[model samples]
Target: MSTIAPARVVLEAAGIRKQFPGVVALDDVSLRLRSGEIQALVGENGAGKSTLIKILTGVYQPDAGSVTIDGAPVRFGSARDALKAGISVVHQEHNLIPQFTVAENILLERIPTRLPQLVDYAAIYREARPWMKTVGLDMPATRSVSALSAAQMQLVEIAKALSLQARILLLDEPTAAITPHETGYLFRVLRELRAQGVAVVFVSHKLEEVFELADRVTVLRDGRNTALDHEIKGLTQDQMVTYMIGRSDVLAQLPARPARGEPVLEVRDLATEAGARGITFSLHRGEILGLYGLVGAGRTELAKAIIGELKVTGGDVLVRGRSARIRDLRDALARHRIGYVSENRKEEGLILLHSVLTNMSITIWRRLRLFGQWIRRSSETAAVMPLVKQLDVRAHSLAQQVGTLSGGNQQKVSLGKWLAADVEILIIDEPTIGIDIKTKNALHELIWNLAANGKAIMVISSDMPEIVRLADRILIMRNHRLVGDISNSHDYEEVSAAIMSRLS
Candidate 1:
């Protein structure tokens, strides 16, 4: 029975190498995927995880090494070629078309073709249902992709992979926005897939989930394979951290700061257009306030209302002891000096097609002119370049489109844009969502420094540990209303209880 349970190698990469203009993106990185096994890939920001995944999925061709599937060498020239070779990647970003129905998005290209090669719409919907069920998704197949939440869209991504009959799945940060319930469902599906002899490579920053789901763990650092193992049962989280960072001393130690000063923001009975109930909160100078809740709990809605992006049906907002009625984002920014980092950075924050310098300087363009009549490109680069450097935004050049950078680098640009704007009150929604650990630590440090400088910060996160680390006070919202507050304690169980109770 033990011998039968052992799996054989389904896919193997031998000495994979890739390079960018100024960087050795991947250097002799080797990975093994066994049939019916889930392999966890753990790494920091520049650890070559993305590079390797791209090579495997044929997004970027490798300079050296070869990929073998079931003991046969294969060269994949494109993502479609990789898919044809039984490799499917569910990226952190959902690639589904928002205007299309779930059924249409699922069977996007492979819709049953008639003899004349016309699309069979009814056949497409029929084929999508069982795939959705394979992942515990039950939304109407006819529903538009635009109507689904982040978690639901994630399920659709998995279903898309399944529709292609993927034997080797590469899931990159699939659970970042997923709730625990949804995560449980996804894990169950992966286990079933493993039982069916499908190999899976799971990439995530969540150490706890890695321990729970991975059959083996591989750590990458500085574009090299640092550690590989078939078992992580004996390794502590601290050990994993050390392997990923290449140093035991890189763990973050929160600075001990004095209590906050005067209140900078006050909300009384604020309600959003999304029907969040009367919500009240206060943010003090040099303080970090965290808002936590289950999916659909209205924490994001509250953030939207506070930022004045959504209409407030009731209540009032006060900025530094003065009654302020924020009817629009312009009013909010001009009067309150508020900065909002949205959860979906691609959609709500950065203009992906624009240059990094342009994205970073757009908010401060009015202040960068010589006589308020002419634009200064040199001055703009001088002001934005340092910020890009400080934030460690990786790109070939400042002229590169923001969309060309990796997910983590794009997020840094988003944050840099807000920092350049010099916002007084910062509302960060899921600040580290989909980012690797190294980048996460950098962002956490940046937020702490911002708070220390007397900027009021409201951190909205689904990650319980993140809220526990940085927030001076934690506010739990459930069903569009404030549930409870926890302070001066780092008990995740307490926060979990509050979140569960409010959600229930």
Candidate 2:
């Protein structure tokens, strides 16, 4: 009987080491990607997954290592050089220009031109059609990318990569924002790419996706390789967790608590300008109320409406049984002692250009003021330092820019600012999105503890496992309205089924 031949290695990195100031990002890490295969690169945030990707994509040069493509040694001085070498990346953040058409974004690198350096619109659309079809993107080439959904935008990124004739494609946290149906579509596309002899590197915090998609896995821990290209068929999820965190238990079980005191915040028939209609909910003291939904299901909109970010056209908001009129986010925090930790930390949650001290203390700057106007630096430092230490923020110093920290640390800073504000009610949106498993567990524990200490927290998340684990009760929303409210028993299968049923 004849057997199929093993796939050949298309790309290899050996003895890769990278270091940043005050931290060794990677130490002697290596990865190999075979043609017609999907290789999963996973690790805790700050464990050097991003660093290695940057090295391979020529965004950052490795301190000591060698990269070879098809048995030929190569050094890329820039991202353009890597692209020329048939390597392309679709980052977690969408890289498409908002105002540009699909055709323009897909063929941006080498747009066809007419005389006098004019863009050839007809040629651009014609050239982009095949790549768009390859990725199952059926949108018109003339459509502006800003109008597309998150899933659609991702397909455009993939189409753009294909337009470059990339032999190897790297996707970073590709499904962190999409729904289950959308994720299945993405997996289908990746499988098709693998069949076409393309090498793919998939990076994600979600292990289930890694198991479902990747053929082999390379696990990283503490900036080093724990498992290098192990076949996925032979490994269990527990084993993968062990490889990642040196422990079998990925997340510690939070203790169940009896329902506490009367409602701390009550929303009655809340109608928002952002499409949330007739939303009514009561969050009691020390309760972790989960708001679960698919993308654009108004979970975030509900939170924004509650925090006064969205205009409440018709609603009665009661805080501690008293009617409250919160004018804006400042009013929500100062007058009502309610704080919001936004999911888009890079944009709304944090001032990335500023120091950690500045971002952490910004929420309480008014409270820290003395003499009716002047703020004391000593008082601010004293107040913010405890939160910094409590959150275990991994920064060299308070002066370090928030932009320089890892995804996990930046999130901690985002949460820390609210803790500094000493808010009684907190709305946390997508608390663990784009973070690693270990950091995710840490954040989950922190939220649980806050609720245990009599703080009302409304968590908005698309991750079912997270909502099930951390929430005492879940409120399901669909099509800008609440569909079901269920108490949690903490059984994944049971809770997930009920959650999905609500969506259906």
Candidate 3:
């Protein structure tokens, strides 16, 4: 009576519904992924993208839904269950053990056993090299994953999925941490996987990549599909952004530059042992200085040197027209009233298991105490509530664990963590690395506001558009050296060429 589809149906979900205390994350969402199609899942922050993916991957069981793989209905109670059903998820953050070899990480649970039930290390090395080569990753199976960079680790995660016989692969923000060359490599792998009849659900906020790689793009807003089957062809980036946010007015709310005042920070011949050399810069009150470069271009190194995280080999730092000795981070904080928002949010910034209030209050603990021995919860709450409200941190309450928040919210916590400490000179590194478009604009507004209040801001980012939009003056760092400065020009090509010249 009915003809079945010839293509393999890798996964299907029906009426998925997920709820939290105050957030209905997913509401009756339905999706079907075919064997070889690259389906893109896109939305603004807190738009149920992560929740739906978690449901599919069995990280969280849907309160009301049914998942079917190869036409067989299944209830996946745990991640192990989902993996056993031929599904694998590679998170934005790598989940591999750093100390383990690539071969061990690839064959994490199902390592081939010898007759004595011991791990066959030699066999593992022999088996893993070809798989790594298949993905165009050139690394020995015996090498530790810790020694690899961020992009290399991502390749390892994909390789691990390939080892698991992943019929359906979930890539959550795969290109966020990679370089342009590595991004191309990843795109090639995605194409190869699609050709081999492996379904992929790619989640990312970078619309360019989404349209470039996906066949069909699904847009979700407030747990409902705006456009589930929108073809990528003939789709404008602005139109896609509008569909995700449900409004055309977001672009009009950009900040207007008023003025930039006198110099608040000055550095001369600043050099760090870790490749930062002969750097000289100045930041004025009510000014936002942008440092743009590739991943290892000494942008962050210069920030650390200025903030006293890295020792200055031979240089002088002046704050508000006075010679300052920033021997250590705390000393710099105490003497110069400086604050730094680290690039690595999870590892360097926030305590995941701690509540938002606790993370915000960690810096101002003594300020809220009556006798420096007892904490005043009310005072701490009062002090943190305004910042929480101002930053638009979404949660049931400030008591919610920050780890449970989205990437954008986590970044807000990182920024708020420093703002709560009352730092005048703020150094923000990669403020919107993995954030969505909506969140990125919100953060840009916040940074503009901070600069408008006469708080000197130093922004270091790899995103060229962000740097061009925010920087009053742009400094190009290459090979740990400040090559050129763009003070009066906002020309993208000129600035980009200046930074890229050093790589050549």
Taken over the whole model, the C-alpha lDDT of each candidate is 0.85, 0.91, 0.84
Top model by TM-score, which number? 2
Model 1 over residues 1-504: C-alpha lDDT tens digits? 011156898899989889899999888889988888888998987799988999999899999999999999999889899999989999888889999999988888587876677888888889999998888788889999999987889888888888998999999988887887788878888888888788889999898899888888888898888886446667778888888986664535577777799999999988778988778889999999999877778888888787777888989889999988776666777677988888999998899999999999888888887787777999899889889988888898999999888778888898888788888998999998877777787888888888998889999988888888788898988878897777736566775665567557
What are the RMSDs of all candidates, in order?
Answer: 2.9, 2.3, 3.6
Model 2 per-residue lDDT tens digits across residues 1-504 = 001139899899999999888889899999999988999999887778889999999999999999999999999899999999999999988999999999999999999999778988999999999999999998899999999988899999999998999999999999987888899999999899888888999999999999999899999999999999898987998999999999988685788766677799999999999887888999999999999998889888888888888889997999999998888899999889999999899999999999999999999888788988988989989998999999999998999999999889999999999999889999999999988888899899999989988999999999999999999899999999999999999999999999999899
How does residue 5 of candidate 2 score in lDDT? 32
Q: Local error of candidate 1 at 355, Å?
A: 3.3
**Which residue segments of model 2 deviate by more than 4 Å?**
1-5, 20-22, 114-116
* Two-way TM-score contest, 2 vs 3, winner: 2
**Candidates 1 and 3 compared by TM-score, better number:** 3
lDDT-based ranking: 2, 1, 3
* Winner by lDDT: 2
How do the residues 261-366 of candidate 3 rate in per-residue lDDT, one tens digit apiece? 9888999988788977777889998899998887888888888888777878888899999988787667767778898888899888889999999998887786
Candidate 2: what lDDT?
0.91
